[model samples]
Target: MEKIAPVRLSVLGHPQRLAVFRLLMRRFPDRIPATELAQALNVKPNTLSNYVSALMQVGLLTQERIGTSLRYGIDMQSARETFDYLLLDCCRGRPELCAPTSNFDLNNKASKKYNVLFLCTGNSARSIFAEAILRQEAGDRFNAYSAGTTPRAGLNPFALEVLQQKGHDISVLRAKNVSEFQAESAPQFDFVFTVCNQAANEDCPAWAGQPVSAHWGMPDPVKAEGTDAQKSLAFQQTYGALRNRIRVFASLPLGSLDRISLQSTLDDIGQLENGVSA
Candidate 1:
């Protein structure tokens, strides 16, 4: 069996490499293109190449060629082995202190799946990304939707490209005005998040459920200019910011926390640093 070694530790020791690893883990079992990875990390292609090579050499990451793209993914079996190896002799046979994996219930049931809505000014990029991220990450526990104060004619192509590269299904997503949800027949939402500054400050229709709302302001990637590379990078950063915040939000214990605590936690998640770790 492969064991955790100094080499693997060294490979992950670099902050950027570690960040890359975490990003891949967020999309576990799915692979993303190398170009997309570089864009997401805001690193030069050459620099990302070096990091990927080092990680792959230590059996931490795997790559495959798909058409003209090189897709990268975490080596889950190797990762699990490494984690087990690290905890093998932890706490000197005291299982309690070691916190053995089996000690915790992995099947705790949530009371119900929550309905969530992501809002923005355009519903073309930031809100779109948030909707996709939350749906993909917590579909079993949340019904995710997105809308705009002033809907765009269509989805942003760059947003679709970035989401496609990350293996998210973009076929059914569309830009719609928030008035659609304001109708009495609309599904009652449990949570509502505004993912851009303009939407957060706008006058919103009163939701049926009076959903707890919070603002998670992220830069508008659709407005990014310069070279194609720069635009792609901007989209990637926006996607990353939404993915991280959504991940944190999805992990909250909704069945246990009261409304005040849940609202506080939601606000805290919104306060997380945009496009970077909080």
Candidate 2:
């Protein structure tokens, strides 16, 4: 029997490296200043310089200097190819396996479209963004919705602005509690992602069907403060992170693999970014 090796994208152990990589991958084609990244992660300049140097050394990041400022970004095309290599083993010289691996029924599933629910505690920033991000990112793939276990009175306005800046029309977004989707009355869900630390630890709504659940806890961007520019920057930052993950999710192979293999693919999709990690 031939055993297939699992995909490996970024070096996974250190949370700091993951943070920097996630930031870099969050916005492709647009360079983020190293100074800004250091501030965002609450690290020192010298320490962040070392991280950038290491990532560039490993071909996971690229840096350019303009005057006194240094900007860093992923070489998105190559970065995504690196991730594709891990999953499809294409760079290992097997082009055949790299082709689309289908598992889901897109045509016949008109009657059975998968639903996804994103849960958080506040329903203000992170969960709201995830709902918009997934809808815009995977519009045809799944029906994505968001609700907080402890719902806020209204959706975060910054979240709305972030979605608008990303070119998504989200006039229909609103905040509601998780009681809206309880087991006895909830719509069946195929996946559930909890995006807040509070909600992940709380007793969650009992999903009607067994959904593939996970957590992608992000710091509350709204909780961050400063000038309007500073707060807006925070929303843009968090929006970029969630958007990257959802992009990877939308590109997944959907027609050829068995259900078990497809589930593995979905799990990997969340862990791996569509670009370089460092």
lDDT against the true structure, per candidate, is: 0.79, 0.69
* lDDT score, candidate 1: 0.79
Tens-digit per-residue lDDT, 1-278, candidate 2 = 01212211344235777677766553433467878788867899999988777667656678889999999987655565666656555347665566444333433344545788888887877888888888877777778889987788987787887788888777778887888877466676777877755565454434554565665666789788999889999888888878877776667655455556766555454444422143
Candidate 1, residues 216-245, lDDT tens digits: the string is: 778899889999999999999889988988
Off by over 4 Å in 1: 1-111, 275-277
Please give each candidate's TM-score. Answer: 0.59, 0.56
Clash pairs for candidate 1: none
Strongest candidate by lDDT: 1
Model 2 error, position 270 (Å): 4.5
List RMSD in Å for every model shown: 14.7, 10.9
